[model samples]
Target: MIRRRPPAPLQDAALVAVSLIDVSAHFDAGEPLRMACAVASAFSLLLRRRLPLLTFLLTLPTVLFSDAVIASLVALFTLASLSRHRTLLAVCAMAFTLSDMTSLPSPNLDLAQTATLITLGYTAATAAAPVFLGQLVQTRRDLSLRLAEISEVRDHEQLLTAQAVLAKERAQLAREMHDVVSHQVSLIAVRAGALQVGTADADAKEAAATIRRLSVQTLDELRHMVSVLRASGGRPTELTPQPSLADLQQLVSGSGIEAKLMTDLPHDLPPTLQRAVYRTVQEALTNVRKHAPGATASLHIRHEGDAVRVTVTNTAPTRPALPLPSAHHGLVGLRQRAALLGGTITSGPTPDGGYELCLELPAEGTA
Candidate 1:
């Protein structure tokens, strides 16, 4: 359970009212100067938040000339809370103690008396109280801010760990798809092709041809899937070490195809930006697999000015590419993500009988 503190204006008004009561209790009717000093000191507390030193100075006359001291204590506390200069706070505290102990008009200088010594101790204790409370408040606020920053960093690390795990799993899945699924589909297409050539009846010939075409199409889709799965964190071994293209050979070979990854990229890129690059590569690889069967692919990641550039290129297909239905939603999604992060994605066919895809992301990773 918690209780909210009163608004500042209301709290300030209450302090002022209390100071006035203290003043009226201490000052006599015939003494105009004493009454005026106490009245001015009480009003000065309104300025404590903005001009603490000036507020304390205005209240000091009351401490010296009259018994009213609430305004001066309040002002001192405000100064301590806002300012970090320990030397200044100590000086103000000493000034306040000396002012309260010395009775003016006819000063009480007989410190040898027990009453005088007790009064001195009492005034010193009163002045130290506000300074301690103000410092404690400041420390608590700073600690809270530090804790919030640490928590944010921890959340970000957790997200990266999750992505790493997903990448490793996808790599494993891609292996299964390439070795098992693709092999079965390839055999089906081969058998259907042989049947189409051997069949004599027109209806049988058309059916065999349709089966062969559908099998080949499915095989093309499987190749795309194998590439997407290889987008895993280049075989993330552990979080202790930075993962990039270090284990890339394993991923390229694991695809059960001829692929290579080359990077001169810095290891300290923002995790979000890195994730975006990984997604872009997934799409590029998928395009290569679907449209260019038997093509050799290469990826180059590097720094260019204030941004990161990742380019994927694949040699032309050994077999004739069969047309497949596509809305190109994956490429559109990548472009939209890049725009949000103040980056860009571009792709085209290469002059060397290959296709090239490039993604550029701001190194600062700001949107």
Candidate 2:
């Protein structure tokens, strides 16, 4: 950070030169000595950071002894810069005049000539210092303040750029989900509706019923995903139902994975929390469908004190394994949802040669 200080060396040198020239013109004799004393006094005032009071005291001795009119003028300027009250400057001026008058021998000259010259010298120095230094300080202060403001503006612009990039990525993910999952669910829904209208065989009717149920479940999941995207406007006034531990059986059956479910859950769970649990299970099963078709799966849901735990495991397919196209976005979304609800999820291949997913969520408000 920049700190405020007295004028730069070059500026101080220039001002000292001006002070010497103006003060020296007043003296009829000892011109060189008077000019030297004036410059010395100006240098002392400029060197001391705190209002030059000691410099003013030092200048007093020079002003008293020297016949140099310039030395007295420099002392008066130092006093004006150092003191706030005009009365103090006036008092110093009078004292310096008396000292100069006393130093001179009794001569043809009277008090009037000495007093008039002293008054003119003191007045000029006092008026000049403030006009010059006041403008300098004001300009420096304005420049410092402007630079600080510019730095803050640049920092804010960088923060805004980072936020814009994150928002663009989120929007792109939303569009892709809509295209993939929504399209698949819509096709399933249309096929089920047609089968309901035209199918007469018992097996055909049963197949249609299964398709309709899965289609509706998939539609509900899509709606929740969309709601999450839209919630960025603000907290949603109403949250869509989220699938939880209770929905594991239906999710497995609907996905055509031969599955078994074992659970020790309470009769009820908080809807918000249950949804997180359900989505974790749902995502795991969807991965199984895509990567391990014809594999058997097992889901376990257990309630421990203050938390509900879920684990889903699916065996690897017997057929030659195909490299499934990954949608890493689904896992990213699942992890985010779990974190928002104060939960955790883990997915990997199990030691027993099956894909496994484990999830845990707080049950504070859940039964």
Worst-scoring 10-residue span by lDDT in model 1: 236-245
Task: Indicate which candidate wins on lDDT.
Answer: 1
How many steric overlaps are in each model, in order? 0, 3
Instruction: Give every collision pair in model 1.
Output: none
lDDT of 1: 0.76
Residues 1-367, model 2: lDDT tens digits = 9887666676656666765665555444655564466556656646544554465565555454454344345445545644556566656666655655454334232546877677556655554554345445556667888999999999999988777655555554464454347545654654575575568988988888788777777777775775566444222221333345556666666765578888888757877677667666667766666567557888898899998898989998754333333435567666766786788988899776779888888888764
Clashing pairs in 2: 242-275, 243-278, 244-278
Q: What RMSD, rounded to one decimal, does every model reach?
A: 12.7, 11.2
Residue 56 of model 2: what lDDT? 57
Q: Please state the error at residue 339 of candidate 1 in Å.
A: 35
Worst lDDT window (10 residues) for model 2?
233-242
lDDT for model 2 comes to 0.62
